[model samples]
Target: MEDIRDRILRPGVNCGQLARAHRAAVLIDGESYFAAFRQAAMKARRQMFILGWDIHSKVELLRGDAAVKAETDGAPITLGPLLNHLAQNNPELEIYILIWNYSMLLSLERDPNLRFNLGWTLHPRVHFHLDDEHPIGASQHQKIVVIDGQIGFCGGLDLSHYRWDSSDHEPDDPRRTTPAGDHYGPYHDIMMIVDGEPAAALAELCTERWQRATRKSIDVHGQNQWDAWPETVQPWFKEVDVAVVRTEPSYKSRQEVREVETLYRDSIRSAQRSIFIENQFFTSTVVCEALEERLREEHGPEVVIILPKEVDGWVGNKFMEFRRVNILKRVLKADVHGRLRLRHPWVGEQPKHGVMIHAKLMVVDDIFLRIGSSNLSNRSMGMDTECDLAIEASSPEQEAGVRRLRNELLAMHLGFPTDEVDNLTKETGSVVRVVDLLSDPERPDSKPRGLGPLEAQEEQFPELVSEAEIVDPKRPLEIDRLLDIFIPDETTQHSWLRAKWLWVVLGVLALVGLAGAWHFTALSDYANREVLAETMAGMARGWTIYPLIVLAYLIGGLVMFPVTVLIGATAILLEPLPAMLTAFAGTQVSAIVLYFAGMKLGRERIQSMAGSRLNRISKHLAKHGMLSVTLIRILPVAPYTIVNIVAGASHIRFVHYVFGTLLGMTPGILAVTIFTDRLLAFLRQPDLSNVLIMIAALVFLVVLTRWLKRRFT
Candidate 1:
């Protein structure tokens, strides 16, 4: 073993911490990774840390031979149950889990916290926290697990649903199903396991993340000897120094970091023989240009990349493909020597679908092996929080191990033996040449179980290409960008410096920023439509919801809340018809309360509260009467409550105010309620027809928004 103090990883450069590990191994696919995790977890004595973008309670962590032991030993096989079982058995063992507070869009795919926290079977020693401390539009995407500071696992494999799969990735693998018995397609991923100094270093990193997320320090109990490494897995490298790289967006006082991105560019420039990559996405232009630069060289290394045929969702696939195609165009144009190959793994014959390659791995000339949660996407490079492990060969044995690892990965993808890949690589000087020798055919489909050329699908909707930057941003959503989206720069210029409409600018931008950020409240934890319906139905039966609903509207109005959001919430909690009527009543009541409050507070107090623009708008409302109030309601001119107060201060007649409120508020309330109901339906059971209908509705809204903007201006 090497000295732990002889660290090669430099902080703020290529890694947060670099240390030597006695043994390090790569576990291909979820079956191997999950099984190994279960084995290592079963050996935990003091503490464990689990962190990831998604951590479902129902993930099946063990199967095959591991499942057999679960039945005999009376230990649960599912991740949540297994951990709880272990915790109950060993009172000294404290398991801490920190998972991203995922968006509402992913609620159905993830289990509610009730399954992990409220269940009677759950053990007290198990601590769980939904991490929401990240910058807007960025997720805590690191997948890392540390067991008692001895053994550590870090990679793209999350302990979540639809992750478990054999290396074969057969198209119709029956084992690929959710806990509720719904089927999924072939999936692929990788996990790296390490012990010795690297394990302890990773433990330190995990605890730091925990402290940031939970505001509490994790007490580390030390042990020099670690025998918890999984017995089934074989070490790929021995006596290796590995660097732990990280990527994080700057937020508040925390500085930004992009070590993974920096290393990718550096490794690409240093490649002597080849660049072999397997990733879910390849859309970062920065990385594409780095490859493009290398490809332009007269005798540069060949570059080979493997990507999935499709992603999970229709919208995500379309957007990612749009971005990927654009990058593919740039790289192919630079490949003057034709030393580039892009491929997708297939079954015995090309089928309707193929394995989803979720591994984030790169081998540059077999001299550097990089693997972890970072996909070759813009978000993974900057916006999203990411972690990766890299080892630059400092010895001949280490260099050979890197070559062997890349060869093994290529062999599995091509459905050939590892030794065959090794031999072919030696026979041919180039990986691109090796793939050609193996895959070239007189006719298409001649080779059943080998690499298939993958190119960008034709752009049926070229308009989606423009949305690549918005959908896969490389940095946090800034307030200035969001403000520009809502209010034009010219509109904010004169007002910002004077701090005249600064409050208004911030208020308006807050609404847009919140949407773009997808930042959720605690209510988002129980955001499933079915869950909301059930919970509210029980509350409704108690005769308690009606008053609380009115109270919420009043409080929300006073705080300048977005009334449409409240309306949408009401729609989710009740039948569509009831929701519309309730929203109308709540808004009308809230309006009257604010209107009277404005009268009592007078013009001076109103100006102090609603800003200087209130008086200007009030005069317009007072003169136009019902028509002005109606127009304001239809447009996003001001907050709902702010308008009510200003209208009260105006000399507008009370009768006209009542009629305008009814006319203006009805359409918005109806639209929000109907849309909320329909959106829930689509989310519950998505189909082509539902998607088409939603598109039509979106187009209609765009036209309406333009008309409203013109009229209001």
Candidate 2:
């Protein structure tokens, strides 16, 4: 039978294209990649294109250089300033940098004023752009650096804060501090450097992405006369072919591409001796199933995987963690011959904080080596845009290079010399056996690169980790198809009412919430309507009371108190007519106060609080006249006061704001006042007609809310 590698691997199917590299080297860890990139950038004569998921302006690319930092006028040798210096020094060189336009959720986590500073610096040769042209939930995740179109670097390392770390991966390394001087855990990632034709190929990829994002054409000239390859960085493979694979979501009418996933699946299936993978995430069901299938065969090659011990984000912790655990369990179940091993890299005496493993890398025996920004996650497979570079060993020399790189990576993580790892592997004829022999099970707490198997406690949550399978599906699914999972099985009379069950269920929940509020809150016990009305009317005559009410609303907004509760209180305290007018005036005042307060806090703070959803919603409201504001006010998609602040921060017009708030609040104020004012009467008389009327009003409110949501959203 033909080898699976020969049969499954093909251009445009499992990869984008094949290109030759006169010289290629693997830069292990961010420290090495950053240094190499810095040297190359400094030597650029024409153009330098830098692109990443994130690019921090002040991220220290060259750390531990007290003399060099002082020599540079103490201006901090960060990525932004360094690039500016390089561009300014080389007047003919054009530097274009592209970073993903991250959501507001990460606004505070990154530099708050990076965009403004980058633009205000006013360097004609330096250009910076934010790529926000991807699909809703997707990100541009390629990390590439092309210098003078002659030398290029591509892999998982991003020129950002806390990404720089030595190969030792000391958990408590003092050099692992951020630009803000806050200490962080040691990080690990890899990058590949290629010179010659392959570098120009990567440069072409960067140009296409740049044009797509900024609509600006970046001229790709012929072979560069200048050589930008760093003299210090030695080549690992000479005269080899590198395959460039990509994963692009279907957006802007472009066809979807899953070349990265195809390459990964094919590579796993083709492993003859061993399959090794190290990734930050392992939540792709398809990849897991592929591995599980291979493990089912009794004579299958041994598989070893290294992952971070804990998930980093909300979705990662709850959703991805679940999927990871579930998939590992399935793989273990299929591993009847015990050929699979999954562990995380540890560096403590007692297994304290594990080093963060961010490298997306795979090695299949000695035939294939891959390293890039494509994680073994669902997003990398088909949602997020990704790029990976791979090399298939076609000759003895190339195969030796691949094998040596894999062994070097293992030695770094295992705290063993490269030769020792090789000797152990040769002695045992198994990669897993070598790892087991080096790992100290009896003294698992020992430091440096002790391996810690995933804890036995993960078996308890079989079903929880599987929830991430929804968002991390391995293939591209259309919006309609993805949404259909939420639809009910039973047919409905009206095609437009296909989601009627959702509305019905929401209505029931709302009613239950109302009942709970009435029962568990002060509303039921404090039924002194006459006393409250008299007291409120007596105070209403004084001008001081109005300011106090407005002040109270302002303070309420600051504390994030629910506006509905305040409105309900207004209905209970005053008569219907006065309460209606008071509600209108009070809400407008509150909105005005909060809007300006939000303005004072600035858009960054407001956005951080509102998150990306509120920012997106505020943009919609700003684009419309009164309808968007009115819809938002009525539907309660977000907290009322926060929306007001978001509107203020987002620069919605005051006229539109006041009118929309008035129109949107009309129904709610009237309904609540009618219910509150008539509550005591209904209770005393037990009038069925009044009760039926209140029920009808509630139903109408629900129906209107649903209609507005469908129309606007």
Scored by lDDT, the top model is 1
**Which residue pairs clash in candidate 1?**
none
Candidate 2 clashes between residue pairs 3 or more apart in a chain or in different chains:
322-465, 323-465, 349-445
Off by over 4 Å in 2: 1-3, 63-77, 116-122, 313-319, 350-353, 441-447, 456-713
Best by TM-score: 2
lDDT of each prediction vs. the true structure?
Answer: 0.75, 0.72
lDDT of 1 by residue, 314-390 (tens): 43554677788878888988999999998987775545457788899999876788889998999888888898888
RMSD of model 2 against the true structure: 10.3
lDDT of 1 at 665: 92
Give the Cα error of residue 281 in candidate 2, in Å: 1.1
lDDT of 2 by residue, 1-713 (tens): 23687654588789888888999999998778877887787778888888898777767776666326445553335677777787777778888888886543334345545566542373778888777656544568899999877898999998988688988888777878877799988688999998877788889999998877765677975446667788779988999988888998875446789999989889988988799899999878778888988898878889999888886654465456767776677878888998888888877555566878899999999879999999999889888889999999889999888889878877887788889888888788998987787787554543356667864236433444323433465544332222222222223224442211111111111222333344446864433445544655576665666565555566666755556666667776666787777777778888888778766774666456434434443444466747656766776444566567656776467788879888988878777777766664567676897787667767876787677656654
Each candidate structure's count of clashing pairs: 0, 3
